[model samples]
Target: MTTQGQRDPQPAGRRPDGRSERARRATRTLPAKALGWCVVVAVVAGGGWVVSRPHPGDWIPGLGPSSADATKTPPVVGNPLPPTDTDPEALTADRYFPAQRTIEMGGYKGKRNGARQGQDCAETLRARDVDPLHDTGCQGYVTVSFSGIDHPALLSSVTVLRFADDASAAKAAQALRAQENAAAALAFILPDTTAAPAPTAGAQQPRVEAVGHYLTVTASRLTETHSASPTAGASSPGVTAGASTAGQSAEQQIEAATRAVSYAAGAQFIWT
Candidate 1:
């Protein structure tokens, strides 16, 4: 028998406060374990997000004018040509004009003499023909003008020949020999003749252009002018004369001419 204010006895496996002690302990522990698991998952997820983010300075390097970026750039086009000078009297003549009266050999063709005799020999052949422009069988001419800057004549011209055959060309050359001055007869052999392709519409033959302060030589024209120089009459100007940038001797020019003539001749032969 208990007093009215006293508590009753607990049942087996049950807590005095209605819940079992074990159950209560378990309820409290479940929340703590869930919270721990949630914290661990959050930490893992946060680490993965940081790793997936891009690191600093991962962008492409700047290429400036060469950049291919399209969004921030405009399409590039070639620069416009500058206005030409219109003054008539301002036109300057080539300084090295009245070329040293020398003959230069260039083109493709075999010769009776050695390559060294080809240029002068070709000149001789041309001089003999009374009608060099009309009847001569030779294909072309090369004019050389002396350049004080380089103790050498600037080659200015290379005329192509349109002869029917080797015999006709030889005859024209023979005639030239009779007409050229002895002193002007120096040979310059060119490289082996290279075959020329048939000219297509709007296509021209490839040619060489040599330019200097006082001279300019092309396949068609060799001009010498008295162009002003930075160094006046300073005879011993530091700039090397008669030596190619490749350190080739002056005679190399003759060799080159020989080979060129040979190559041209071979081409003509093939075309014909």
Candidate 2:
């Protein structure tokens, strides 16, 4: 007979505890195998998360979603005004400038040739002058060609530029007056007649001022010449006066008269 502490005899394929050997082996390995599968899944998930995160310089293109335009911060839209309303259809130069310029020099009167409007400074301003204002978002430009100020007087022209906003106009006015570039004023359209014995540059420095969203650039003298070397006396103020002042008076009367015409032409927009 068997003792109480002695176990029962095992079957060929079974254990002494009454379980099959195959079942016991499977039970022992189940936890370890499950743990290994869990580790693999965690590693894959972590890798996916790492690759998906985006950064500026470190971003990978094809591996995940990455584009500076789409993902990065929005672009800065500084204080800009409505571009469409500034078309200048109503507040153009012709609407305000007088047809006859008051010549205060000798109590004589002068006449304005004509006014032209342009969508930009390209067609309205001189090639050299077109550069600075064109890049400044200049939307509207109106130029009145050289006025009828012949010998003994200085011819004048007026140009009004409309910017996207008042601030832009002001800034452009400041830069222009400071002579940051070669642009003095808009191109003066000579009359159908031949070139005049006018000065190569403005008799009075081009005047630039801002009113609302508009910048008015005015000149007190002609911009064409018959002389080949008009810049000779320019560098030296005390040197020989060039063809610009050939026949014009040296007194304030001519200067004052020319300024009067320019101011009158642009006066309408002062309160704008």
TM-score of each: 0.26, 0.48
lDDT of 1 by residue, 218-241 (tens): 221111224423322222344433
The runs of at least 3 residues in candidate 2 whose Cα sits more than 4 Å from the true structure, single-residue gaps closed, are: 1-89, 98-108, 128-130, 146-153, 180-185, 193-203, 222-248, 251-254
Give the Å error, residue 82, model 1: 36
lDDT (Cα, 0-100) at 258 in candidate 2: 49
Best by TM-score: 2
TM-score for candidate 2, please give it. Answer: 0.48
lDDT of 2: 0.54
Residue 128 lDDT, candidate 2, scale 0-100: 53
Clashing pairs counted in every model: 41, 0
Name the regions of candidate 1 deviating beyond 4 angstroms: 1-156, 164-166, 182-244
User: By summed lDDT, which 10 consecutive residues of candidate 2 come out lowest?
Assistant: 73-82
Compute the lDDT of residue 145 as modeled in candidate 2: 46
lDDT of each: 0.32, 0.54
